[model samples]
Target chain A: MVRLLRFLVEPLVLPRWWQDALLLLPRLVCGYLLAFEFGAVKFGLPWSPPDHSLGLFEVAFWFPGDVASYGGLFAVLPGFFAWMGAFSEAVGGLLLALGLGTRVSAFLIICTMLVAIFMQQIQQGMWNTLPAAGFLWAALPGLVLGSGRFGLDYILAKPRRHEHV
Target chain B: MNTSRLSLWLSLGFLLPACVQPAHNKTVVYLLDVRGIPNVQQVGLRGRDNPLSWDQDLPLTPVGNDSSLYRTVVTTRTGYLVTEVKFTVNGEFELQQADNRRIAFGAPGDTVVYRARFNVAGSLKP
Candidate 1:
């Protein structure tokens, strides 16, 4: 069991360079894709070309309805939560990619992923959960490791370290 | 296989923002007692699990011999959440309350593959 757990988290054991590359690279891909490409149609610039259907600053009507249907606190203010979720996927994804407020952004991503898991992914099956799960897994390390040495978090923190010298 | 699956999911991800509905597992509703219904052209399903909302009502196609069973696999994110469904038969008659409407997958990795068999009875048209 311990070995299994290690296998799951073993990616963290890589050398500094490898870890930094892993951290920076995946964050770039996942965050950028989620923000500008994947999530943009739903949450950003409202672009719907002749053949496409996309919107901006608008959570699809069905999203809140689905959240409300999930019941619990989600039923109370589904719109607020829906907006938050969408924003996190869009703006938060950008911040996360940039390593700005690395831990905080990761935390937000974590919350969105939790919803994706229990609220959405759980129902859709594992296949549907992969994107959420991938983000969740990627964000966990970011939350713990501060987005690695290559990230803005490090660049910002670097000056502080030199201040003592 | 993994690569193909991953690409498919990525494509789905791109499409998801425009269609921001809850994730739902595929559910097959074997609507019983649909035989007596007159001119059953199409069957649709809606439910509380869907928060009694969702613009599109899932259509149930006729399956098996004699059209006795209308088959439609619905999708939802929750596994055990009881989906109270009402079936609109022939675009007129309404059949509410169904059994096994809980849409669930066999395991975590198989979200697209649902193992739920919803055998709902028409239970008299109102």
Candidate 2:
């Protein structure tokens, strides 16, 4: 269990503090947009707009149908995928912003962004695909490098004096 | 585990169950036939109810390959007996002199289909 926890919380160390700080900027911006704007509109979250009338964790009614329209596997279990996609953008993005479980959150965001770019926006032209593409790029760093120095992962993973390294 | 880790796990446990949707006894299927409108790029519905705010437009999906017909499904908790709705084409609400179209819900589990044409007053086929 300890070993598993270590794997989940571990972050990639950078050579310089400025390098970690530079990566943190895009992560923060992208995470905020995903959780508050894109995700909250389709998925239920505490900060969702009042006009949407979404209860906590209840996805918008139109979302599952939209996902199913992608066809094939999405059609087979639209509800599950819709929920997952929404959760990734909403909760996972929040985790990304907080630098908690950074890799897992990045992985989920990457999957959703890929589908958004390929399955949905590809036909709509390059302009429509830009937003998803931007998100994908931002998440790629988190997936590879985890949160680095300025994240909750680093703080949590600090070696405690009671435990031998 | 430390206090922070335990609290994090406990918070996630509580949040997971909240994803279960509430039971909805009423279902409303709104259909808008925009055959008369030329070059309709978008169709949306705004209404007076939960999930359907007058201030926000809920976009409708085109039905199959038929660009003229758009549809959306709304599920609500029981006791929503009636609602007022207005259709929009390209973000402009129907400019009807008459009041907004009214939709009366049937019994629980019964699907109510409200069909109307764009900008045409008294054209609703309930």
- Any residue pairs clashing in model 2, and if so which? none
Question: Model 1, range A17-66, lDDT digits (tens) per residue?
Answer: 87688668878877887777655644544442211223455554446666
* Residue A74 accuracy (lDDT) in model 1: 76
Off by over 4 Å in 1: A1-15, A45-58, A160-162, B1-126
- As a whole number from 0 to 100, the lDDT of residue A145 in candidate 2 is 89
Q: Tell me, by lDDT, which candidate is best.
A: 2
Per residue, candidate 2 scores C-alpha lDDT tens digits across A25-49 of 8899989999999998777888987
In model 1 chain B, where is the ten-residue run with the lowest total lDDT?
A: B111-120
Model 2 TM-score, 2 decimals: 0.62
Tens digit per residue, CA lDDT, model 1, B1-126:
699998985664454444443333534333534666567677666665543333446677767767566655544554232345555664443523434243324332343322222333423232
- The per-prediction CA RMSD against the true structure, in angstroms, equals 16.7, 10.1
- DockQ of all candidate complexes: 0.05, 0.10
